[model samples]
Target: MKKEKLLMTPGPTMVPPAVLMAGGEPMIHHRTPEYSQLFRELNKNLKTIFQTQNPVLTFPAAGTGGLEAAVVNFFSPGDRVLCTSIGVFGDRVATIAKAFGLNVEKLTVPLGEAVDPRIIEEKLKEQNYKGVFVTHNETSTGAYNDIEAIGKITKNKDILLIVDAVSSLGGLDLKTDEWGVDVVITASQKALMAPPGLTFLSVSNKGWEAAQNSTSPKFYWDVIKARKAMEKPSPQNPYTPAVSLLRSVNKALELIIEEGLQEVFHRHSQLAKATRAAVEALGLKLFAAPQARSNVITSIKMPEGIDGEKVKKQMAEKYGVITAGGQEDLKGKILRIGHMGYVHEGDIIQTIAALEKALIDVGYPIEKAVGIKAALEVFN
Candidate 1:
């Protein structure tokens, strides 16, 4: 029999049993009234999770597709936009914008640090930008930006405040409407407690008006087309949707709602705090800055002379605890532990114990059970 392993990656986190069972159910016709009713209910719950009163649009694609959609639908070629970067995902937004012939101005901060809203405020004063792109949580470095602060800076301006909440939404508190974010993009994986395949975005009235004038070439990612299909008496996607994934997401949303959003966010916060404490007790340093740390994922720096990949490998092979390595420039230098989406106290304890053992196996000197003890103290 195959050994059971805990998935602790930044995305594609472990799914709940109910969510898995929902995905296994038999498929239904997308155009049928039954499916339409399911779709409508799903959209309503999504708005609650997003904390927005606007219509949320769903697409049959990954998180990157949502990013591309935001870029293609909001501005035309030659339009000036500000893309803020703190890690890989932040830079990805700028890459997509540049690919579409937009004049991109990148405002980047050091790795493992969150973007300072004051810099954005100062930049806005220098140029009349069409949009400002921000990543609520940078998964690579485990840095969390303050969307509320940035929103306050851009709310009254003519610029659109676009946010990539792929890893933050549903896991953190995001006031989409209250924060004045013009466009919010997220995926089904991550904190949604569902399988990958579907991506969703909530667009404000300003976003829609901007779309009307956008000349960027697009068809499959057209939000207007999606909105039209959804506006019908029987709501549906512009194209054939991911019925199984949608079913799983519906069940996942139900679980989140049942748990209560604030309680869920608190659980994530406690889990992250426990994980951070465990890492510190194990003599391992965290990668992200303290004030900017993310609750969904914790990035830890490799111990002196220890290989991050080896630590990750030993954790999975010897202990059946799967974790992720860093991306781009930080690869093999950092180990990321994800504690979001259906994760709990027991899971954190188990992972900390496994990590302690794995660190010892990889030639790092550390007392056994220290990490677990630290984590337990947090829970107690």
Candidate 2:
């Protein structure tokens, strides 16, 4: 079999060689003072990236685990929670809320659009809810909800604001404290550019209070236990962490700080712009509305009579490129081009070229070389 080419999918995306090395730098004991110091440093660096005065808790799980921690720790059975269902992850939030026996009310928009805060305000006025969940970047649809505005509406209200920022946390600007976000959850992959396994959650004082009231059954994901353990002078966890992954995470955060957050976001913006230009030049429609498109990923509508999955396969098998197909109800209706984390302008150009070939292979006609030309306008 041919060697698998580079990963240009949303995640686990391309890992920088340095971070990969860090992950492979010999496993260490999770209990020693050496590991404790490493954990402490990792926690401190995470706080800087999250821009939160509150503690940013780390776990040996994926982004979904972080979400579960937020739900199980802060909400009990019969707790009223409002979830926004705009895409796959949003629906996952609602599902988790239901599994925890919470009373869930989901406010939904179409796959490509964002939920309006005014609508949320109207719901808040009509009824009482203990918490609200919002996904900052809907990776499935490549739509980014306005969490800052949403938080503004929820401030001083009786609801806790939970955010799923897995794909957007480090790529985009998220000021957890200033935005009034009660709990912000993220993963080691995506913009963090680390291997999957580690999860991060920043909880506010209000979120902790909710946890005190919560009667949910949780041991592995118990925020209170993790918080207490983290506060120890040694800074170890109740459970063993993915030590190597955390090492990579520390280095990844270092890279983010070295480049500066603003410049990092700017790079993502330029790459997304170039990808959009290339796709539009090929006469493909974008799934996300202009205002709601995520800088991390761009979901494009599949042209009529084309198999989106076939395009993904062709790109991988034939062109040495990898791109993501749509999810859930959008399985064959769209294709997602991710430009987050380690994705640079050259990666965007190569993916566009592979996509053009795949499109033509699947019988969509387009002038040769036009897409790349349009994309170059952004790069040059």
Candidate 3:
């Protein structure tokens, strides 16, 4: 017999059994009325999740693909944009912008700290940027930016506010329309409780105007074409769509609505609090700043003289619990535990117990059951 490993990574989070069963259902033809009805309903539900009245476009790509579509559809080659980078995903926005020939300026903060909106406001005043790129929740460092404040800064201006809500949407509260966000991008695999393969973006009216003027070369990622197709008698994608993933997302959205969006957000907050408390109880330090901590993922600093990779490996092999390590510059120095989507108190408690044992097994001094006891206290 083999042990079932608990997936605690930032992405590809555990999928609910209902969603899995939905994805396993018989496939429907994309051009048929059946599929079109399902697609339309999915988009409608997604608008509720995004808190927007705009059209939410779906693509057969990962979260990165949604990010690229946002860049190419809203800005031309020489447009000036400000990318406020706090971690790896935030920096990726800048990298993608530069790759597309945009004159990118970065307002970067330390790895685990969120970027200050005041600095961004001052920078915006100094330059006439065409757009601003920001990550709503940076999973790399477990930092959450103040998108509402940033949106207020760019809302009345001629600048477009594009957000990477890849890991945050469905897990956190994002008021897309009220916050004046022009474009919001997210994927299915995170808090949406679906498999990876599809990315969704909602474009405001201002975002549509920017798209009409954008001269960037695009075919598969063309939003206008997608929107046109979606508006037709039988809604469909510009290219082949992930029908199975769509079915799964439809089910996932149903579950979210049943639970109520506010309740879902509250659940994530409680889970994060419990996870953080458990980590601290095990004598570990959280990586993200207190005020900027995210409810999606929790990144912990690797204790002195303890190998982060060893801890992760031990958690998987010995305890059947999987965790993620840091990326890029912070690699081997931090560990990330995801508590989004289908996660609950039991999952968090199990992961913390596994982590406590893993730390002790990897030569770190930690008392047994301390982490689980702390987590239980939070749950109680």
Q: Estimate every model's Cα lDDT from 0 to 1.
A: 0.94, 0.91, 0.93
Each candidate's number of clashing pairs is 0, 0, 0
Q: How would you order the candidates by lDDT, starting with the best?
A: 1, 3, 2
- Return the top candidate by lDDT: 1
lDDT of 1 by residue, 19-64 (tens): 9999998889999998999999899999999999999999989999
lDDT of 2 by residue, 207-230 (tens): 999989889999999888898999
The TM-score measured for candidate 1 stands at 0.99
What candidate 3 gets wrong by more than 4 Å, as runs, is none
Candidate 2 positional error at 283, Å: 0.8
Please report, as a residue range, the 10-residue window in candidate 2 with the lowest summed lDDT: 1-10
Give each model a TM-score. Answer: 0.99, 0.98, 0.99
> What does candidate 3's lDDT look like per residue over 1-380, in tens digits?
99678999998989999999999998888888899999999988999999999999999999999999999999999999999898899889999999999999988999889888999889988999999999999999999999999889999999999999999999999999999999999999999989999999999999999999999999989999999998887788888889999999999999999999999999999999999999998889999999999999999999888889888899989999888998988888999999889999999989998898888898898899988888888889
Judge candidate 2 against the unseen true structure and give its global Cα lDDT, from 0 to 1: 0.91
Q: Compared to the true structure, candidate 3 yields what TM-score?
A: 0.99
Which lDDT value does model 2 have at 241?
86
- The C-alpha stretches of model 1 lying farther than 4 A from their native spots are none
